[model samples]
Target: MPVATFSLVALDCPDPEALAGFYAGLLGGEVQKYNDIWCDLRTPDGIRIGFQRAPGLRPPSWPRADDNAQQLHLDLTVSDMEAAQERALALGARPLDLDDDGGERNFRVYADPAGHPFCLCRT
Candidate 1:
Protein backbone atom coordinates (compact mmCIF):
# COMPACT_ATOMS: atom_id res chain seq x y z
CA MET A 1 0.00 0.00 0.00
CA PRO A 2 1.05 3.56 -0.62
CA VAL A 3 2.29 5.41 2.41
CA ALA A 4 1.33 8.86 1.17
CA THR A 5 -0.45 10.54 -1.68
CA PHE A 6 1.19 12.85 -4.20
CA SER A 7 1.44 16.52 -3.40
CA LEU A 8 2.61 19.70 -5.12
CA VAL A 9 6.11 20.37 -6.35
CA ALA A 10 7.58 23.52 -4.94
CA LEU A 11 10.37 25.34 -6.68
CA ASP A 12 12.85 27.68 -5.07
CA CYS A 13 12.97 30.95 -6.97
CA PRO A 14 14.05 34.52 -6.39
CA ASP A 15 10.48 35.85 -6.73
CA PRO A 16 7.59 33.57 -6.02
CA GLU A 17 4.91 35.62 -7.68
CA ALA A 18 6.95 36.19 -10.81
CA LEU A 19 7.87 32.56 -11.14
CA ALA A 20 4.31 31.48 -10.53
CA GLY A 21 3.11 33.95 -13.14
CA PHE A 22 5.46 32.45 -15.69
CA TYR A 23 4.08 28.98 -15.06
CA ALA A 24 0.53 30.28 -14.97
CA GLY A 25 0.98 31.78 -18.41
CA LEU A 26 2.51 28.66 -19.86
CA LEU A 27 0.31 26.13 -18.11
CA GLY A 28 -3.03 27.97 -17.95
CA GLY A 29 -3.33 28.06 -14.21
CA GLU A 30 -4.69 30.30 -11.51
CA VAL A 31 -2.05 31.88 -9.31
CA GLN A 32 -2.77 32.18 -5.65
CA LYS A 33 -0.42 34.24 -3.54
CA TYR A 34 -0.39 33.63 0.16
CA ASN A 35 2.40 36.12 0.84
CA ASP A 36 5.37 37.82 -0.73
CA ILE A 37 7.49 34.77 -0.17
CA TRP A 38 5.12 32.10 -1.46
CA CYS A 39 2.70 31.53 -4.31
CA ASP A 40 1.19 28.61 -6.09
CA LEU A 41 -0.56 27.78 -9.34
CA ARG A 42 -3.48 25.44 -9.78
CA THR A 43 -3.54 24.24 -13.34
CA PRO A 44 -6.64 23.45 -15.32
CA ASP A 45 -5.72 19.81 -15.08
CA GLY A 46 -5.59 20.11 -11.30
CA ILE A 47 -1.87 19.99 -10.68
CA ARG A 48 -0.59 22.30 -8.01
CA ILE A 49 2.84 23.87 -8.37
CA GLY A 50 4.21 26.03 -5.65
CA PHE A 51 6.83 28.73 -5.93
CA GLN A 52 8.68 29.85 -2.86
CA ARG A 53 11.03 32.76 -2.47
CA ALA A 54 14.64 31.80 -2.09
CA PRO A 55 16.87 34.83 -1.97
CA GLY A 56 20.22 34.38 -3.66
CA LEU A 57 19.11 31.12 -5.18
CA ARG A 58 21.13 30.32 -8.28
CA PRO A 59 19.26 28.82 -11.19
CA PRO A 60 20.56 25.50 -12.33
CA SER A 61 22.77 24.99 -15.36
CA TRP A 62 21.26 22.79 -18.06
CA PRO A 63 22.82 19.61 -19.39
CA ARG A 64 25.52 19.77 -16.79
CA ALA A 65 26.73 17.14 -14.37
CA ASP A 66 28.74 19.48 -12.20
CA ASP A 67 27.89 20.95 -8.84
CA ASN A 68 25.23 23.19 -10.35
CA ALA A 69 23.04 21.26 -12.76
CA GLN A 70 19.42 20.79 -13.72
CA GLN A 71 18.11 19.48 -10.47
CA LEU A 72 14.61 18.96 -11.87
CA HIS A 73 12.42 19.95 -14.79
CA LEU A 74 8.84 19.86 -16.01
CA ASP A 75 7.67 18.28 -19.24
CA LEU A 76 4.63 19.70 -20.99
CA THR A 77 3.10 17.97 -23.95
CA VAL A 78 1.62 19.88 -26.85
CA SER A 79 -0.15 18.93 -30.02
CA ASP A 80 1.50 21.63 -32.10
CA MET A 81 5.14 21.95 -31.26
CA GLU A 82 5.78 25.08 -33.31
CA ALA A 83 2.89 27.01 -31.85
CA ALA A 84 3.73 25.98 -28.32
CA GLN A 85 7.35 26.97 -28.82
CA GLU A 86 6.35 30.42 -29.99
CA ARG A 87 3.93 30.87 -27.13
CA ALA A 88 6.49 29.78 -24.56
CA LEU A 89 9.05 32.21 -25.94
CA ALA A 90 6.51 35.02 -25.90
CA LEU A 91 5.88 34.25 -22.25
CA GLY A 92 9.60 34.73 -21.46
CA ALA A 93 10.85 31.18 -21.82
CA ARG A 94 14.42 31.05 -23.07
CA PRO A 95 15.34 28.31 -25.47
CA LEU A 96 17.84 25.97 -23.88
CA ASP A 97 17.94 23.19 -26.49
CA LEU A 98 15.69 23.35 -29.52
CA ASP A 99 17.66 21.01 -31.71
CA ASP A 100 15.12 18.22 -32.03
CA ASP A 101 17.32 15.97 -34.13
CA GLY A 102 16.05 17.44 -37.40
CA GLY A 103 12.42 17.18 -36.35
CA GLU A 104 12.74 13.55 -35.44
CA ARG A 105 13.01 14.10 -31.72
CA ASN A 106 9.77 14.73 -29.90
CA PHE A 107 10.93 17.14 -27.28
CA ARG A 108 12.65 20.52 -26.89
CA VAL A 109 14.09 22.15 -23.83
CA TYR A 110 13.54 25.66 -22.52
CA ALA A 111 14.14 27.64 -19.37
CA ASP A 112 11.50 29.65 -17.56
CA PRO A 113 12.03 33.24 -16.51
CA ALA A 114 13.66 32.11 -13.30
CA GLY A 115 15.90 29.74 -15.30
CA HIS A 116 14.16 26.51 -14.37
CA PRO A 117 14.44 24.09 -17.28
CA PHE A 118 11.30 22.61 -18.81
CA CYS A 119 10.49 20.70 -21.95
CA LEU A 120 7.74 21.22 -24.49
CA CYS A 121 7.17 17.75 -25.78
CA ARG A 122 5.40 16.96 -29.02
CA THR A 123 2.38 14.78 -28.59
Candidate 2:
Protein backbone atom coordinates (compact mmCIF):
# COMPACT_ATOMS: atom_id res chain seq x y z
CA MET A 1 0.00 0.00 0.00
CA PRO A 2 1.15 3.54 -0.66
CA VAL A 3 1.66 5.75 2.31
CA ALA A 4 0.60 8.88 0.47
CA THR A 5 -0.64 9.86 -2.95
CA PHE A 6 1.19 12.44 -5.02
CA SER A 7 -0.12 15.98 -4.83
CA LEU A 8 2.20 18.61 -6.31
CA VAL A 9 5.74 19.80 -6.52
CA ALA A 10 6.43 23.29 -5.24
CA LEU A 11 9.48 25.29 -6.08
CA ASP A 12 10.90 28.29 -4.25
CA CYS A 13 11.91 31.16 -6.45
CA PRO A 14 12.23 34.91 -6.36
CA ASP A 15 9.21 35.42 -8.60
CA PRO A 16 6.42 32.94 -8.38
CA GLU A 17 4.25 34.21 -11.20
CA ALA A 18 7.10 34.27 -13.69
CA LEU A 19 8.06 30.74 -12.84
CA ALA A 20 4.47 29.65 -13.08
CA GLY A 21 4.16 31.28 -16.48
CA PHE A 22 7.28 29.58 -17.72
CA TYR A 23 5.99 26.16 -16.78
CA ALA A 24 2.50 26.98 -18.01
CA GLY A 25 3.86 27.84 -21.40
CA LEU A 26 5.89 24.67 -21.69
CA LEU A 27 3.43 22.31 -20.07
CA GLY A 28 0.19 23.71 -21.47
CA GLY A 29 -1.32 24.55 -18.15
CA GLU A 30 -3.59 27.11 -16.51
CA VAL A 31 -1.79 29.28 -14.03
CA GLN A 32 -3.53 30.59 -10.94
CA LYS A 33 -2.13 33.22 -8.68
CA TYR A 34 -2.99 33.26 -5.03
CA ASN A 35 -0.89 36.32 -4.36
CA ASP A 36 2.36 38.00 -5.31
CA ILE A 37 4.17 35.31 -3.42
CA TRP A 38 2.30 32.24 -4.50
CA CYS A 39 1.20 30.65 -7.74
CA ASP A 40 -0.10 27.28 -8.87
CA LEU A 41 -0.25 25.70 -12.30
CA ARG A 42 -2.40 22.77 -13.29
CA THR A 43 -0.93 21.31 -16.45
CA PRO A 44 -3.07 20.03 -19.26
CA ASP A 45 -1.66 16.59 -18.58
CA GLY A 46 -3.06 16.89 -15.04
CA ILE A 47 0.08 17.62 -13.06
CA ARG A 48 0.05 20.42 -10.49
CA ILE A 49 3.12 22.50 -9.90
CA GLY A 50 3.37 25.29 -7.37
CA PHE A 51 5.67 28.24 -7.18
CA GLN A 52 6.34 30.00 -3.92
CA ARG A 53 8.14 33.26 -3.33
CA ALA A 54 11.48 33.03 -1.61
CA PRO A 55 13.38 36.23 -1.09
CA GLY A 56 17.01 35.82 -2.04
CA LEU A 57 16.34 32.35 -3.37
CA ARG A 58 19.21 30.64 -5.09
CA PRO A 59 18.40 28.35 -7.95
CA PRO A 60 19.90 24.91 -8.08
CA SER A 61 23.04 24.11 -9.97
CA TRP A 62 22.97 21.18 -12.40
CA PRO A 63 25.48 18.36 -13.06
CA ARG A 64 26.88 19.13 -9.68
CA ALA A 65 27.33 17.20 -6.48
CA ASP A 66 28.20 20.00 -4.16
CA ASP A 67 26.06 22.12 -1.88
CA ASN A 68 24.33 23.73 -4.85
CA ALA A 69 23.30 20.41 -6.33
CA GLN A 70 20.18 19.89 -8.37
CA GLN A 71 17.63 19.01 -5.74
CA LEU A 72 14.79 18.24 -8.14
CA HIS A 73 14.18 17.93 -11.85
CA LEU A 74 11.10 17.29 -13.99
CA ASP A 75 11.17 14.85 -16.89
CA LEU A 76 8.88 15.72 -19.80
CA THR A 77 8.30 13.21 -22.56
CA VAL A 78 8.37 14.44 -26.14
CA SER A 79 8.11 13.07 -29.65
CA ASP A 80 10.43 15.28 -31.69
CA MET A 81 13.57 16.14 -29.81
CA GLU A 82 14.54 18.97 -32.13
CA ALA A 83 11.16 20.64 -32.13
CA ALA A 84 10.75 20.23 -28.42
CA GLN A 85 14.21 21.64 -27.83
CA GLU A 86 13.39 24.63 -29.99
CA ARG A 87 10.10 25.21 -28.19
CA ALA A 88 11.69 24.83 -24.80
CA LEU A 89 14.43 27.28 -25.72
CA ALA A 90 11.86 29.70 -27.08
CA LEU A 91 10.03 29.41 -23.77
CA GLY A 92 13.11 30.44 -21.75
CA ALA A 93 14.73 27.09 -21.09
CA ARG A 94 18.49 27.24 -21.23
CA PRO A 95 20.36 24.20 -22.40
CA LEU A 96 22.26 22.48 -19.67
CA ASP A 97 23.41 19.43 -21.63
CA LEU A 98 23.18 19.51 -25.38
CA ASP A 99 25.88 16.93 -26.00
CA ASP A 100 24.26 13.74 -24.85
CA ASP A 101 26.93 11.33 -26.17
CA GLY A 102 26.20 12.45 -29.70
CA GLY A 103 22.55 11.36 -29.62
CA GLU A 104 23.10 8.10 -27.87
CA ARG A 105 21.32 9.31 -24.76
CA ASN A 106 17.57 9.39 -24.59
CA PHE A 107 17.22 12.71 -22.81
CA ARG A 108 18.45 16.29 -22.79
CA VAL A 109 18.87 18.59 -19.85
CA TYR A 110 17.81 22.19 -19.46
CA ALA A 111 17.36 24.80 -16.80
CA ASP A 112 14.09 26.58 -16.36
CA PRO A 113 13.76 30.30 -15.85
CA ALA A 114 14.17 29.82 -12.11
CA GLY A 115 17.33 27.76 -12.78
CA HIS A 116 15.87 24.42 -11.82
CA PRO A 117 17.08 21.60 -14.02
CA PHE A 118 14.70 19.45 -16.07
CA CYS A 119 14.87 16.93 -18.89
CA LEU A 120 13.07 16.57 -22.20
CA CYS A 121 12.97 12.82 -22.63
CA ARG A 122 12.28 11.11 -25.92
CA THR A 123 9.13 9.03 -25.95
| Predicted structure with the largest TM-score when compared to the true one | 1
Runs of candidate 2 with Cα error greater than 4 angstroms are none
CA lDDT of every candidate: 0.93, 0.91
The residue-level lDDT of candidate 1 at 71 comes to 93
Error of 1 at 122 (Å): 0.8
lDDT string for model 1 (8-111, tens) is: 99999999998898888888979999999999899999999999999998889998868888899999999999999999999999999999998899999999
The true-versus-predicted C-alpha distance at residue 40 of model 2, in Å, is 0.7
How much does candidate 2 score in TM-score?
0.94
RMSD of each: 0.8, 1.1
Top model number, lDDT: 1
Cα distance off (Å), candidate 1, residue 50: 0.2
Candidate 1 positional error at 6, Å: 0.7
